[model samples]
Target: MGEWIQSIADTYKAICAGEAPWVALGNFMNAWYDYAKDQREALVSESLPALATSSLEQRRWAAFCVASVEYLCQRYGLHCPDWVYQSQYSLVEPWFHAVNPHKPQVRARLIETTPEPFTRRNIYCGNKMFANKYEFAAQAGTTSPNQAI
Candidate 1:
């Protein structure tokens, strides 16, 4: 992999390791989006779906990428429809959808700040849908993982 890709990979690893994850996650996502913009259809349609049946490691990496996008949306005031983060909103959807790549689908007014709202964000619990660093910072100006609580 190129140094740029490798750096993003490292950020993903650091995030899994719980080391400066918020910053690393942001960096990794920025790089991923940049690359995605270049690759366009092939990356979103072919590359991402290829991971669906890939080996465990590759699949995990794919999941990490999806999660990173969700994280960026939540943290950066980018809006996503509540459903976008859910499993139903597969990685392949963007290729077919004409929406702005950087912005979320749902308007900002509808995005709940709570970690686990009354409405389930996904088919599985928290497979996605959680606050970003800014959301965490707003609450007592501290970061606390809410799902566990």
Candidate 2:
């Protein structure tokens, strides 16, 4: 897990440095898809305990890694055609977490400004959005019809 996270962080750093985000996203996505079934299960069944117990920094890094990859994937129009993300979609949360971090205002703007392919409709906001209407609802008070705060 540490290695995977490190690899992801490195990838994000590379992307931030303007070094072909698609290449990193592709490599990371390939690794993820290789073990996605196990990872999907671990996200809910096993790894979550560790993730939950991890320091906020650790969790934050994890979230950043996930978000970076997902964002790059979307930016490059890469989709997880094989990874269904069926295990409660826990992996999806990090994308939002990475985007929002601690600022709800930015989170809201980022969520609202996100393009169609990256919007809540496509990603379901990890079920964070309560209803379809609230998905696009102005980010107010954390919880909206489309998402749960």
- TM-score (all chains, Cα) for each model: 0.29, 0.30
Q: What tens digits encode model 2's per-residue C-alpha lDDT throughout 54-131?
A: 544344343444544445455444553323222322333434433444588766665665444344223313322212
What TM-score number comes out for model 2? 0.30
Q: What does the lDDT come to for candidate 1?
A: 0.39
lDDT score for residue 57 of model 2: 39
lDDT of each: 0.39, 0.41
lDDT of 1 by residue, 1-149 (tens): 33444244465455455566457655644444554434322222222233233544343444545544445456544553343244633333222111332345432222333122212321112223333334444555554434323
- After the best TM-score superposition of candidate 1, give how far the Cα of residue 95 lies from its true spot, in angstroms: 28
Tell me how far the alpha carbon of residue 65 in candidate 2 is from the true structure, in angstroms, after superposition.
1.3
